[model samples]
Target: MNWIYLIMILLATVAGGMIPMLVRNLRPNLPIYMLAFTGAFLFGVTILHLLPEVYHELGHEAGIYVVLGFFVQVALQGLSHGMEHGHTHLPAAEGHHHHVAVFPLLFGLSLHAFMEGIPLGFNYSDASALPSLMLGVMAHKVPEALTLITVMMHAHQPKAKLWRILIIFACVTPVSAILAAQLGQHFELVTKSLAYMVALVVGAFLHISTTIFYESGTKHHELSRKKVVAITFGLLLAFLTLIFE
Candidate 1:
């Protein structure tokens, strides 16, 4: 709820979306590797830190929310086309371009971001977990931003419209966090709500991370060395974060 924390989250969100646009000249594969790293890091943090916290706080009942969150993410991907996990497949819009119906994708991604913001704001006082959760969310946002921008470009969306959507998406997280924080101040059951929300977010993270890992490699174990290194580094960083926590 602190202004500095909110500002940090906002800056991180904007940077994630803008950095990919700024680095257009870089090797395409670099972002892909980064996606792998972020995915692995998210997975590690969820499994190592968030899951334990949620179960410890809420008991076995929390598992139900986790399961629900897993399926909710699966459904969201139907609209987002797995963009959250770095999948950016889009049909070609070469000669005869048409405006793509990007609203569904935007809505899906925004909802996901909003859900993420709730736990972030609600748990801002948890000194041990807050930093890791924020970092994991920020890391996940980068490749997601890259994937989203790429999809819009492929669909021949106007630059102005694309920027509008990106800006809105960037704002959604902090706004949700602020709103959740305000609600928590007024609600008696805020702690219970936050616990459930955290469990849900953990489930969503599990689905996304597993999907990224499953899709990163080719048949016959043909994963790239760079991707392997990225994943390993991501895991190591997450472990260190856990230790600090």
Candidate 2:
């Protein structure tokens, strides 16, 4: 077994997941600019990296999953706001709150995070794909970690509780990667099944990326004119990086 992959992933799990928590704890209320920055990072990864990679590898079936992913998140977000969505709810100055996402909501949330890497993790044919996928996971996970931290801090929850939430979030990716790495090997002999799982995860990413945009918008006044400009620029850059990457 390549213990390096295992070690690198575990290191990333702890490193990537903890940075934002430390930031949030140090400053309980993050500025909107900071949140927007996180959103921009998300746009860069999802649009620039994750989505294009999925489509290139899986094509139209991946497209369908992307759309499905969007709808699923919309529905999930509708159910509630705050840590439940894995993001901090903006204060009264930013948005509203709901209690729909309780303990039971975790399964869907965890599954969403788990399936994030299923496409590139298990379904890719090229060896070069692995490194970029792993980097993208690390880079993008920063915002996800930030999101959960923001959610917990905004709720003014205790540090111990917040750490617990992050620890749980920490496992979703590494565990998924490990499982995908093992399971993906089997599917190499079964391309169709691989394609189907790829489609499912592509859908998940599509949903996730779009949801980030929606949450960024409505949760913080529905994409102000300034933000629209940021998003436009972000999307253009996203496409350009896709070409290069």
Candidate 3:
């Protein structure tokens, strides 16, 4: 396993999760724009990098898994309450609080993180796609971690427990990557299905990204100017990665 991927993901998660707790006076709506940027980047990366490679390697069969992965994410949101796509209510702003099930939220996000780590563990047909995948995951994780911590704060969880939950959430992907590498080594068949795994993950990415865009927009599904700019910048960055790579 490349330690760099683990380090990068961990740093991004810790920073994102910590920011909400450390800075008491954050702009309540800031996560919306960040989600917009990350959502657009993930959308672009899925189309530009992941979808094509999966189709090229797995052919039409990849389509089924893609659909499955999309619905799978839909199911996950039932458990996560859309936290994976920045569905969070900041405690600082809301006058009242509701009971948020901490376990279900963590389980859902951890599972999503684990699936995202699969492609990182093995070399697929188009090795170039790996970097873009890593970047997409890292970029998205920031907002995800932020969303999780924000929700926990809204639930009025203890600070100590919050830190522990954040650390555990941060490690899920790296641990999954390490386990995937080991499984592939012991069982050759694990590698043969890399394309399917990639396709499924791409599906999950598609679902999350699109949901972020849909939910982040105005009630009429129109984007504010600031959100438009952030999204444009994200897509532009994703495009640059393709050209430069």
lDDT of each: 0.77, 0.54, 0.85
Q: 1-245 in candidate 3: lDDT tens per residue?
A: 78897889988998999989999998866888999999999899899988998898888999999999999999988887788898643224445775777898889889999998887887656656777878888999999999889788988899999999999999998888887887888888887776688789889999999888868634566678888898999999889778635
Shift in Å, residue 23, candidate 3: 0.9
> Candidate 1 on 11-95: residue-level lDDT in tens?
6666767765667676767766887899999898888778888888788998999999999999988877678887644454657
Q: Which segments of model 1 are wrong by more than 4 Å? A: 92-99, 124-126, 216-222
Candidate 1, poorest ten consecutive residues by summed lDDT: 214-223
Best by lDDT: 3
Error of 1 at 54 (Å): 0.8
Q: Please give the lDDT score for candidate 3.
A: 0.85
* Total backbone collisions, model 1: 0
TM-score per model over all chains = 0.89, 0.65, 0.93
**Model 2: residues with Cα > 4 Å off, grouped in runs:** 1-59, 78-102, 123-129, 153-158, 187-191, 217-245
Give Cα distance to truth, residue 207, candidate 2, Å.
3.1
True-vs-predicted CA distance for residue 5, candidate 1, Å: 3.3
